[model samples]
Structures are given as C-alpha cells and as structure tokens.
Target: IMVLLVLIFHLLFSCSHSLQYFYTAVTRGINFPELTAVGMIDGEKFLYYDGNTRQAIPKVDWIKNNVKPDYWTSQTQIIRGSEDRYKASLVTAMQRFNQSGGYYHPFQWMYGCELDGETGATDGYSQFGYDGADFLYLELRSTSYVAPVQQALITKQEWDVAEAERRKHYLTKECIYWLKKYVYYGKSILDRKVPPQVSLLQRDPSSPVVCHATGFYPDNVKISWQKDGQELHEDVDVGETLPNHDGTFQKRAELKVTPDVWKKNQFTCVVEHKSGDPIHMILTEEKIRTNSAGIIVGLVVAALVLIAVVVGVVMVVKR
Candidate 1:
C-alpha cells in the first residue's frame, strides 16, 4: 500500500510545476543556513531579494504549517526553538547572498534546505513555483555547485552513512506519508495554466529594441527575435526565462540595430508556450509604452482631446 502511494505521488508531482524552496531553518545555536540536500536531490534556485517579488521574504504560512509542526514539534526531547528567528535569518541570508557587501557569489541562485533539527524533517515532496498560471521556468534547485570540493571532502564511507541516515530519517517517517498526501493536494495548483504578456521596449530612438514576455505557465517556452521573416541570430540577446513571484515567468529578447533599420524593419518577437499558439510582438510606437504612467497619461490626454472636440461640435451646432 505504501509503495503504491509513493509511486503515485512520484508520478503526479513530477512534472511541469511550481518552484518551491523547502527550507529547514535551525536558529537554536547555529545561525548558518544548512546546505543539506540528502545527496542533493531535486534542488536548485536563484532568488532575488530586493526585486519586486521580494522572494527573500519567507512565506509565514508555509513556515507555520510545514516547518513548524513537522520539524519543531517532532523532537523527542521537545527542545523548543524560535521559527521567527529562523525565518528572519532566512530572509537575511537571501539578502546577504544576493547583495553582499563587496564579495560576489557567482553561484547561489536557487536555495532550499531540509531542517533536520527539532522539527521532524520536511516530509514527502513539495510543489512550488507554479501556483496558478505561473511558470517556474527552471527547476528550483542549484545546478552548479562545488561538486569537485564535495567529492574531495566527503568520503565513500561518509557518503554511505549519510545516505543511510537520510533514508532512515526521511523515507520511513510519518512525514513521508503526509508529504505524498500534500503533493496530491497541490497537483492541480502545479498544473494550472497561465498565459504570457508580450511587449516591445526601447529606450529613446537610438537604443536597442527589447522584446519582453512575462507571466506564462508550464515553463516550456521559447522566445526569439526575427526580421524580414528570418530569425536574426547575430545582434539578438535572448535571456533565460526566469520565474516571477506569482509563479509565471519573464523573458526578454533584445537586439541592437541602426536607427534606420529600427524605424524601417518590422521586427517580431515570437513566444511559444505549452498553453496555446505562439504569441507574436512587433515593435511600433503605438504598441510600446515604457511604463504604466505612460499608458495612463496617454489615455487621459486622449480623453481630454475627445471631450474638447465634443464640446466644440456641440457649440457650433448651437450657434
């Protein structure tokens, strides 16, 4: 029965899904974020702290529901700790890692840790990233790390022991049972569909034209720029599709061109996603706005002009 359930969960939850950072913060004595992945299972991440999403800020609901009961309350000795402190440390670590004083960490994007302290370990698998119409483009795990260093430091015997411990502590627990159940609950959320918004951007007349696509789902997307019906590869800079806080993704394709070429040629930004047909964008003055204010101002000015024309026509008729 247990075997069947595990297989069922593994099948369902393993797909185009959410970007979850499952973490176990131990704030008792040790203040460092744990880098334990039990042999680095599905784990990778790049977080933006100061950005619009404020992803650095941990979800209190997740902390309270999952981290609190599973890890904190499961201790045999009941050594109480502070989840609040742990949450703060998590946010702080995200900030420090993202925006350090002087040092730069080339790698350290996606991050999640299983708290093995007082709480019983995060049971089962977690579905993050795509919530409702969100596309977590990449797996929310760190793909590149100190692999050579880990190989040098961790011996075979040490590895065998750690694996044994992980299996014993993680696989055979009641948490595992609950985890599969939770995955079942989150299956629909993970599979939710979201469409992308395509737009063209350019700073003044001399700058390169940028094509942006934001808020898409299922993560399987491709965006590229084309001119004269031929895809241009030279001057184009296609960015990696990245996750948004709402679970959607954002990608930008840019190209540098002469002012004459920019004004004359009708360049296209084409996006293909799982939900539907390709979304196409062509750069034009009427279609492009730098920000929401530009849109509002344009609307307001147009409205005032319309009002003036209506009043003038009415006065002429009266006269």
Candidate 2:
C-alpha cells in the first residue's frame, strides 16, 4: 500500500508539471513580452509607457539564461527622448551582479531617462521615429559584469555566457544609435521650444549664466562651460540629484562662467557622456538679461559717449 501511495504522488507531480507547460502554450496572456524584448532593462516604474494602462513591466531575464559561470548577474536600463519627455517620463531601471569569492562585489550598470518627441511633430504622428503613442525605442547595455572568460574557448553549455557578453555589446551599440537619433531631433525641438526646467518666467542675471542638466547614468557625465567654443575652467558647481532608488543614479550639473561670456560669446553648457555624443546649450543674450536696467543703462552710456565725441570733433573743425 505504501508503494502504491508513492506511485500515486509521483504521478500527480508529473501531471501538474505537464499541465503547467500545456497551459503556458495554450494561453496567449502568459506570453507577454518582457521590457527587455523591447530593448529596456529592468527597474521600477518611473514613467508609464501606457500611462492610462499599466504603470510598469518586468524586464526580460535573458541575461539570467545567458549567465556566465564566473559572473553572477547582468542588467541594464535605457531610454531615448527629447528634454520634455525624458524629464517628464521619469522612467527608471535596476540591475545587480552577485559575484563569487569577493567580500564586496560591485555591479556595474547605467540608466538613461529622457524624452525624444520630435518625430511626433514632423509627421503629424509622433510615433514615426522613436516616440510611439505607447511604445518608445530604447536599448540598455552593460560591460560592468565582465568576466575573465572568453566565448570562443567555452563549451556549448557555456555559450549562453558568451551570448550574454555579446548581447551587452549589441545593446550598447543599439543604445548609442537611439541616443543619437533622439539628440538630433531633440536639438531641433529645443530650438523651437524652451525646456520646462529652464525658468523662462524668472530672469536672474546673477544665476551664473546657469545651465542645468539631469541625466541617467550620472557617473558617466562630464559637464563643462564653454565660451565661443572654448571650455571654461572656473566656478563649476555640480549638484546632487535624487537617486531613482533602483541602484541607479540621476544627477544635475551647474557651471558658472562670467556674465560677459554669457553676453558677448556663445556661452554654452556642454554635457558629454561615455557612450554617446555630447549635449549642449547655446546661451542667448535675451535668456540672460536678468538685469534689464543694467543693460539699458550700459547702452545709454555708450550712445551718449559716441554723440559727445562727434560734437567735440565738429567744434574743433569749425574753430
């Protein structure tokens, strides 16, 4: 009787496993694609892709299947958008790598959160380029979990590990391409519209010709002030941004240059990243006229000096 009972239990377990497999195959609902399938990494829900629908979606665990024997985990988060959508979208991601033999194993990862909404305008349908109504194009990559192993030398079972590394490289390139597209269109959008972060309502000349920037992958940013295309080395102040709490960082940098530079030269705030092209802000004189009275007074004084010089020269000639 005991033998019969054990056989029954074993049969039930087998049946259950088979049923689960069958159910997954039959149900379309269970086949939802992870965000990674669409090229996003795992993280908390920052901005909703379908704001009215679901707030967040789990990232695909492709890296898990492709795990290396030497390394523990791999992860990434990515985004592409114009200043408005990027800042407003607020998408966030998280990743971790659990290493062996080390007391403190550091995971390497990065996040990009910004909007590129130019395509929406030009084609009269915002979904053409990168910004779709519910879906945006993005890619995430990480080389932080690098192991000492090589793919060519690995066995078939270890091929997944090599694939993970390969995927990282592929995603990195994909991310760069998307970022460039966003930036290209983002610049065009910026030329037409002022960013919300830039306070157009309040004019403060004393604000150091301030240029503020917020970025995902905060550690990779190298921000500087430039005068007529030359980099400025003085009075740069970088501010701490609130973390996304997903093991990723968001940050802002403030660079201070002379008011004259902001006025006479094309004072620009340039932001450079490790994997992508640079982002820049060209200062407009009108944007910096916080001291309207001072500018007016300076103009008046110059005009009066010119008039006086002309009158004195005329008097000397007449005499």
Candidate 3:
C-alpha cells in the first residue's frame, strides 16, 4: 500500500508539472488547437484556460514563456532583429512610443552602463542609423535562457538612460535583462551539438524512395535534399527521434523522389551543421536486370516433364 501510494504521489507530481508546462506553452504562443489537460502534480502546474475544452495540456519543458521582470545580467545584451514578427503587445508598445515622439528606427544603439555609475551623465552611444540593410523592427532578446526565444517592447526606451557606473553596458543590457527576469526561469539548457552527420539510403525505382538522413546537432538543425545538385522544392517530411533525455534531439528528414531522378543522377541529402562543414549524403544507382526469357523457357520444359510423368502414372494404373 505504501509503495503504491508513493507511485501515485510521484505520478501526481509529474502530471502537475506537465500541466504547468502545458499551460505556459499555450498561453505563451505555442498554440495547440487540440490541447487538453490530462495530468497534474503541482496543483501548481501552470495552465492557460481553454474556454473550448475547459482544460489544458502538460506543458513540455521547452515551452518558453516571455514574461518581463524588473532585473539585469551580462548575457542580456540588447540586440535587434526584424520586428514585423513581434507579438502584438510588442508592436503596440513600439507604436505608442512612435506616437509619443520617440524615434522608432531600426537597430538603434542605445547607451548602456553599470546600474551604479559615478558619471553624472552615462557614457555610451546614444544612437546609430542603418543605411543599406532594411531595418527589421528592433528587438532586445536574450539567449542566456532560451536561445530561440526573444522578448520585445517598443517602450524599453524608458530604461535606456545610463544611471550607474557600468551604465553604458547596463543600459544596453536592461531590455534583455528585464526580459529574462520577467520571462524566463533558469533551467537546464538543451545540450547543443556542433556538427551533425548525414547519410542517404533506400534507393529504388517505380515509386518515390524515402531518403533517410540522420545525426544532427543544435536541435535547430535543418535538413534539405537535392537532385543532381539542385535543391529539392517539394515538401520534405520530418520524423521524431528517440529523445536522449540529455537535451539534444535526434531527428530525421525524409525526401521522396521519382526513380528516374535517382537512376542516373546523384542524390544528395545535406545536413546543415550549426558550426561545421555541412554533412552530405550521396546516393547513386547502378543498372540491374534479370533475364525473363531464359526463365520462361525453363518453366515450359518443367511443365512438359510434369505432364509426361502424369500420363505415365495413368498408363501404369490402367495396365
């Protein structure tokens, strides 16, 4: 009874955490139209209320949330990316700033300094202008938490002034810092891989053959295939891998192509490694044929022998 109770408690706790994760994912933009709450451990599990189903999913560990906190850190440098893709709240914040007479330019280099500075005026670049590159809306994001996730605000300008010693760096850093503090909880990072491997297999004719390419790193790795050296335009299918549980994900990409393409041409599956030379998978086919005419003649002779044997048995029985 005790053991069973312990097992039940473990499950309850796990389910609760799962629900929390599920809730955070859905609420934070990992939309799952088919989401439902199935398990729980911490009545503390975070969940986004689903009005349709009145339930939630156990948020997976990687479902990131972008909350803003009021702190700072070194890895929290403010950098800018295209803002056209920002969340509505961020877009609205920027619009409000522009409406309020703040300069809303792309890649605005704001001054940063230590939170505690001796200079009455903080020392740093006030602003820089972009000339050639189309300025995507500016975003201040941090990879110190979730490498792929970013937090943006059109109005972080309020925190742009250098107030402290290293205020230049700090000022430059505030938006990212605040984003991390507000949005991310420090957790185990995904084990990043450098160079992943590539292999090509399963070549045939008649139907589209599935190209199996494997061994990728940096969870965000992309796989693309080409025919006779041209990139594949058709949609390729991706498959899930057995999780390593250590953070690195194993995955596969499959591309289907007509046998005619594979017949005389070189098929390549390229694994775009995050840091090293791209791994390439190459497939070539050799012509193979079977002689049907010889087989047909042999079959005919065998049938004739069988008929003669049958006739002989009948004659022996009649005699």
Candidate 4:
C-alpha cells in the first residue's frame, strides 16, 4: 500500500508542478467516511477533510506554517458544502444505476491542473468515477463532459456547456494560480534534492542480489544492474518506489544470477538520482549483507564479545 501510494505520488509529480483535489463519496459503509476530500500540491497531500472530522486540516507542516487560519475555515466550509453535494450525487448515481439496498459503492471526483515550470505550458483534467470505473470525464478540447457509461449519459446531458466552461476556467486559471502559490509556499522542501544511500543486500549466497536505495528526495530514481559493464535487463526485478516515513523515497532492484556468474564477472548495481552523480556498487561477496560470509563474521564478532565479557568478569572476581 505504501508502495502504491508512492508510485502514484511519483506519477503525479512527474510534471513540473500540479495541484489536485479529490472527493470521494460512499453510499454506505462500516467504519468508513461517507464523504472525504483531499487537496494535493506537487503530489504531496497538504489538506484533508473527512465526514468524521468535519474540518479541513493541513496534512503537511508547510501548509500549516504558510496558510492562514481563515483559509482553513474557508476550506472547511467549502468542503462541507461539497460533502452535501457529493452525498446527494452518490444517491443519484446509485438510483441511476438501479442499485439498491445496503451495498457499498463509491463515487469519486478528481480535478487537477499541471504546469510545466520550464516551458510555461499548462494542462488540465477533470474526471469522475463510480464503483472504480470511469463514469464521466471532461473533454477539455470540446469543453464538454463525456459520459462513458450508460447511466452517466443523463448527467452528461444535464451538465450544460456553461458548467463545462466554468470548470475549464477554474481548472486552467484558478487551479494554476493556487498551484503556483503553493509551490512558492513550499519551495524549500519541494525543490530540495537529497541523495539516496545505496547498498547491496543478499539473504544468502544463493539468493538474488538486491540493490536497495533509500532516503532520496523527489522520488525520481533509477536503479539498474550491469554485468561485465553491460546493462542486464533479463532476470532483474525492479520494485516500485516506496515512500519513507520521513517523506523520502526508497526503491530496490534485484538481480538473479548464479554465484558463479557474479563471482566470475563484474556485476554492478547503479543508482541514479537527481541529487548527485550515479552511484555504482560493484557486486562482491564482501559488499553483500546477510551473505554466508557476513553471517559468519557477525557470529565470530558476537562470540568474541561474549568471551571478552566472561574474561573481564573472571578478572573482577579475582580482584
């Protein structure tokens, strides 16, 4: 789940800048919020509101430190209004789908805008989903809402061009304004780059070699394996980037090879991050953690420490 979230985060922030809002409404559920809203800037969640909380709160320190209290109050009121509307919409959607009884169904709305910081170009998107399927989406080029499912055709017909125009205006203009403002507010943290700590790990001599890189900021990283200075795409499994507890990112790529192949040829795990030059960790028996040799070394050290403690106790007794 953490990896999934981090992957989404990485994709969201792939562009130069972005501001997104997500609203979810559930028809019925146990221990689940009926309505919830989240606001994200540059892929990082900054504001969150739920039915239980009934208040819009900042999720990040930067937002709390930069945004005014009244802003939160205003956002709370806005989300409260949205909650009522979304709840009603959920019912309407269920009715359209001819669904009844106490079944859990979710209606989601997402709208966002992206800005290319380098080229000054922008893009906008608005989409709605029901029961984990695409229900409707705004066609920015045509300035109209498109219904993907039969049940949503009614909504598409009802949503007038004026509404679509208003959405477009908000997505293209207002959303970009807020995105830029948020970027400025969180520039220090958003723009900063931190290098990753790379290591070679193995469960045992026969296990795959894992190139683990963690504690990297910005979430953009590349990890690959090379055999004899040539990239090896086969027998390599690259895991998804996962979020660290401290907002950094981590990723790992495993290389499956026989001990003979690795020992005979030069195999290297290369990690590329925006923070600095690429890190290359050559595969060697000594560099791999949890290998047979490493375990033996650990046991020897522990036994020596125990013997030293026992000898010291004997000398103290003699004294």
| Candidate 2, 248-286: lDDT as tens digits | 333444556556655666767776664356767677765
Q: What is the TM-score of each candidate against the true structure?
A: 0.48, 0.27, 0.32, 0.74
- Best TM-score among the predictions, by candidate number: 4
TM-score comparison, 1 vs 2, better candidate: 1
- Please identify which of the two predictions, 2 or 3, would achieve the higher TM-score against the true structure: 3
After superposition, the stretches of candidate 1 with alpha carbons farther than 4 Å from their true spots are: 1-15, 18-182, 291-319
Candidate 4: lDDT of 256? 88
Query: lDDT for each of the candidates?
Result: 0.44, 0.32, 0.34, 0.78
Over the stretch 1-319, how does candidate 1's per-residue lDDT look in tens digits?
9999777755665542222233233222333332111111111122212211222422223333434344433431121233344345444543533443333111111222232223334422321111111111111132111212222223223434444445345434544454444444444544565788887776566767677777776566788878878888988888655445455566777777765886698777788886788887876777765554344334335534432221111111100
Q: Rank the candidates by lDDT, best first.
A: 4, 1, 3, 2
Q: Where does the lowest 10-residue lDDT sum fall in candidate 2?
A: 16-25
Give per-residue lDDT, candidate 1, residue 235: 89
Off by over 4 Å in 4: 1-15, 96-98, 101-103, 146-148, 201-209, 232-237, 254-267, 290-319
Worst 10 residues of 3 by lDDT: 16-25
TM-score for candidate 4, please give it. Answer: 0.74
lDDT of 3 by residue, 48-116 (tens): 323244433223443334322221121121101212222233334335435322332222212222111
